[model samples]
Target: MNEQQFSKSMTYAPGLPEGATFYSAHKKRVTSHAVANAVEAALKERGVTIEDIAEIVLDLQKPFMSGLTIETCAENVRGVLAKRELQHAILVGIELDRLAEKKMLSEPLQSLVDQDEGLFGVDETIALGAVSSFGSIAATTFGYLDKVKPKIIGRLDLEKEGKVNTFLDDLIASIAADASSRLAHRVRDEEEKRLSQNNGK
Candidate 1:
């Protein structure tokens, strides 16, 4: 199809108004802030607020970084959520859980997601894949949180009120893990700079 036809056929371009011109629709720029807000809204609708995830981030870094504030943790969490890849992960995982809740997925697959089958590792797989860009520290942190299921992660996993959070719990863990990794590296960079300056002086 020609570019015009292709653009016209696109009815669901993100951050674009309905029936927008082909040029406007195709050329529309999706800002990081918009994606982050959408992801945060999805989490809030699922009863998982930014603050809820930030608490996990705070707990993860507080011991290692003294005087780490919840606001800083929350900012890092927002930074992680703003990433395009991570945003994609959160939307996909949450949509799957939502579909499972509505019994929309096919059998066997439906049962796996709905029951959060222990053998079904795809949930963690997606979560880890999204955060892998952050490096090994983020991946290890994710594994630790997945195993421990701390705070909100633990509560989400235990939910049995017809809520399917198989992927969500892992996704949240990955976000918090990534945020912790970012904070750690940033602090380490600052410390290294300070040490270098002191030595020079």
Candidate 2:
């Protein structure tokens, strides 16, 4: 189908409930298709692609799921949040946007995000949040990242210093992943409602 048809189809999704427009107008509601689109757009804006993100997330999902004991991850995440990294997060985002404008990530940027280096954890968090779009998981994960990234920066070289274990990173990363998944589900629900309402009109 053409882009116009695709956009129209999205506006009138099946099984949408009443009162869904509030979510859409406020941009709080999201559909899976929308998530897909948002992810694509954000990547393109960065001169990166879905493959780049998918590669990182896929690497994360397995070890991130297995070895990261919940408590440890939470504690590590808490440590990151304690440092006050909101401005830092924004600065990093701007830097990334610049890199996109330049059509490539620097070698430093590549190592940090692609390799998931300890120094660039907050950057990773924001990127995940943006592309995930309107998912509760994304919101909450980004919220957590936004809330505590500076602390993580302050606590860098944690593994080298033996201050952290796999468990800690795992928990924080898991928090992000779970939050995004949940966000996707909620967005879909609200989106269905919005689309149904529009159809009823």
Candidate 3:
């Protein structure tokens, strides 16, 4: 088919559910802000601020993509926080952790989730899926985060004060990985654009 015809065919019909849309502004704003707030609060509790996350992002990105400043890394993290898919993943993963903590699951499942069995692997799976959008860099970054367990992630790994963060530790790592990947891509795009302009000149 022609490009115009293909484009026309891809448009959604009216009256579709808000969830069916690629980007529901209201849902995106609310969920993204909530998830961002939760992340900030968790980090604050562990004595890690946004500046720390920015520095971590800079560390994660500089080796992969050159000329990336700390300010750009911090802005990219905010960009990741604004993404609808990231928000959804954060909300869902945290909800699952909360459910497990409450022992809401049935029978053997409850015990398995509560104990965070190695064989289960569901928590990592969810986190991996969240980072998949950013490609292979995300996978490596996630491994780095998992290994280092910086700040909030390390805190979340420990069960303290009757709070369980079984899924959250992995989820937070994925978030950082994804944010780093986002920054890398943005930097790459800008570099490409500059190179193209120079070539044209």
lDDT of 2 by residue, 1-201 (tens): 454334423564444443332244323343444433443344355334333323323343435344434344334223332222322333345455445335466777544543445565655555444434325644555445434533332233143421222122332333344433543454468779999999999
What is the alpha-carbon lDDT of model 3 when measured against the actual structure? 0.71
Candidate 3 backbone collisions, by pair: none
Off by over 4 Å in 2: 1-158
Q: Write the per-residue lDDT of candidate 1 for residues 9-95, one digit (tens) a residue.
A: 454455555333234444544556666777888999988988898899998888999999999999999888878999999999999
Model 1 stretches with alpha carbons more than 4 Å out? 1-31
What does each candidate score in C-alpha RMSD? 3.0, 16.3, 8.4
Give candidate 2's whole-model lDDT: 0.40
For 93-145, candidate 3 gives per-residue lDDT tens digits of 67776777787878787777778777878888888888888889989989889
State every prediction's TM-score relative to the real structure: 0.88, 0.25, 0.69
Q: How accurate is candidate 1 locally (lDDT)?
A: 0.88
